[model samples]
Target: MEPDNAERDPLPKTPDPLADWLEEPGSTAPGRSSWLPILAIVVCVALLSGAAYALVKLRKHPAPGSGLTAGQTALASPGSAWARDFPVSTKADLDGVCRGWYYPQSPAATGPAPHPITVTVLDNAFKMRLQPLSVHVPDGVKKQFRDAWQPADLAKVQIVACVDLVGSGKPLGKCSFTSPKVTTVPFVEGIYQITAYEVATGRKLTEARVIGAEECPLVALVPADDVLHSEVSDRQLYDKLHALVER
Candidate 1:
């Protein structure tokens, strides 16, 4: 007979519910509730990560139509209507020249519009080779005014022009220009598709597809300095725009 004080086999060891649940495979019942907190934490972490990534991307690359930076002006015109369509195009009169279009059938200026007209150059090309030419463009354009309107008219007239690469991704050839030194290391190539607009009326004044070599590209309109003058094709573009306004 066993002694009364003798310890009997510990009452069949009591099963621990937590231990059993942990051991079970895919136990959804009561155990599922425990996973809720962990799942929520994971989901929150993923959402936060996504939000941060988006914020960084936006800061790095500002979206289109957001606004302009310093030294930049708006490109769009007030009224969206085009003044008139100058469909007639011209080719390079001389060999080794670029070709394009200018508005106004006549070389003369229509008259004079309000001073301080805005001109926007839209560069729709893969590469931005026309940037430098854009800087000197105002001088050339102003010269066109003088020629069309006259030297006295230049004082009264003002031209504010800016260049913008709209990222058209257009594949084009080279656009060469003759300089004083000529055959220099510093040179730019590629076909540049440029569109000039009169910002006030939103008129599509002139479009140029310059190829091969040119005399001062569009800068030729300015006769000052030792730089070469623009070819007939290039000059016509500016002249035509002035003609539109002179009207």
Candidate 2:
């Protein structure tokens, strides 16, 4: 047995091992170590946010001198509301009003004579009967339509069979002709695509349709007259016409 004086010397007052380890730069407390992962996450998130911002900025300014027209730009800028608001159709939408008329242009002193135009497109409702506008054509050539049809009747027809003028489906939206005499423009009528939009949302709503009879030439098949100013916008409709007369 040790003497009382030999009682175990007081244990040296050493620092806690855990506390010492924490004080070293190489070591960390459990709580503090957890903060490292959290901080790294925050940094990563900030970087991602910055990259997204840069991407958006790049879109706001397209490449300089891209040669994009205003219409093209309006279509290309999907980041803006205009793209959503003013969507254009790549196809001739059948959702709008359509009208068409055919007339003979009297052959000039030298040009090819126009005649015998074939009727291609007929309203799905009933094949519209084409009567010779001329009295010289025999009555036997007159074939009765299953249903009476008129320009006013186009609204009632649902589907319009459009055979492309070039035999290839292409937009024939504008028409102009020139001669030695004063230039005259005629309105070609058929299948005018009418696009309608929603007022509130600026969203395209439906394709409304307009059908009508175009003015015809007199019995002499006179030269086209100066189209009235009011009809100028409609001159663009010359493209939608399918020739019903083969000549």
Candidate 3:
């Protein structure tokens, strides 16, 4: 036992780095460590990586109701809500509107009308039996479509013709070829598909389709005339067929 009057020596203190740091200026109590900034940086990097991955995914798939597919871009007109220019590059691109057997253009065949083309409408509804409408394939329109492809010897080729539907499969009631009665449908509408094939080999050269609601949807099959009044829908339909030579 030490005497009351004797002085006691202080024990040697162990170094406490954490306690020293906590007691530094600007520190109130033990809180987050100095490494907290590094942790925050790691979190930010992870968030940025996730955002970049999402952007790539969005580019791969288009949003629904955008009137477009993954690779397709829409060419919209100012006042025409129902009309759009569709450019198809592959059979897959044309698959939605073209249902019947389709083939790629013949490798040897550069021009669609290297041979004579026969056009026909293939609607078999009972209503058509009473008033069958003829599909007139005008030489002028044919030349326009054929001109889009590489010119070939028009004198050398011969091909067979096949018929396809345009829009709704319903019978097209009487529509005036001179004055068309264009209408809109809430539910069902008519669509027409015009396909061309090589008569000898039955090879599909090209095809296109159009859609509209009209009492006489067959008006689209009629020949275009300068004196004939035309509707926007009818013109759009004709334009589609005229552009068929495009790959």
Q: Judged by TM-score, which candidate is best? A: 3
Displacement of residue 57 (Cα, Å) in model 3 is: 52
lDDT (0 to 1) per candidate: 0.34, 0.30, 0.37
lDDT of 2 by residue, 1-247 (tens): 7568556788689756456335656566465444665789999999999999986664442223433333333321243222112221211221221122110111111123222111123222233322222222223333322121112232222222232111112232433444344434443443433332221111222333444333433212222343311111222222222122111
lDDT of 3 by residue, 1-110 (tens): 75674576777899675863466665734454656656899999999999989755533322333333422322122221111122223323222122222112212234
- Following a full C-alpha superposition, what root-mean-square deviation does model 3 have from the true structure? 16.6
- For model 1, the stretches where C-alpha displacement exceeds 4 angstroms are 1-190, 200-208, 216-237
Task: Assess every candidate by TM-score.
Answer: 0.26, 0.21, 0.28
Window of ten residues with lowest summed lDDT in model 3: 75-84
Clashes of each: 10, 23, 12
- Lowest summed-lDDT stretch of 10 residues in model 2? 101-110
**For residue 42, what is the lDDT in candidate 1?**
100
Scored by Cα lDDT, where does model 1 land? 0.34
Q: Give the winner by TM-score: 1 or 3.
A: 3
In terms of lDDT, the poorest run of 10 residues in model 1 is 91-100
Clashes of 3: 12
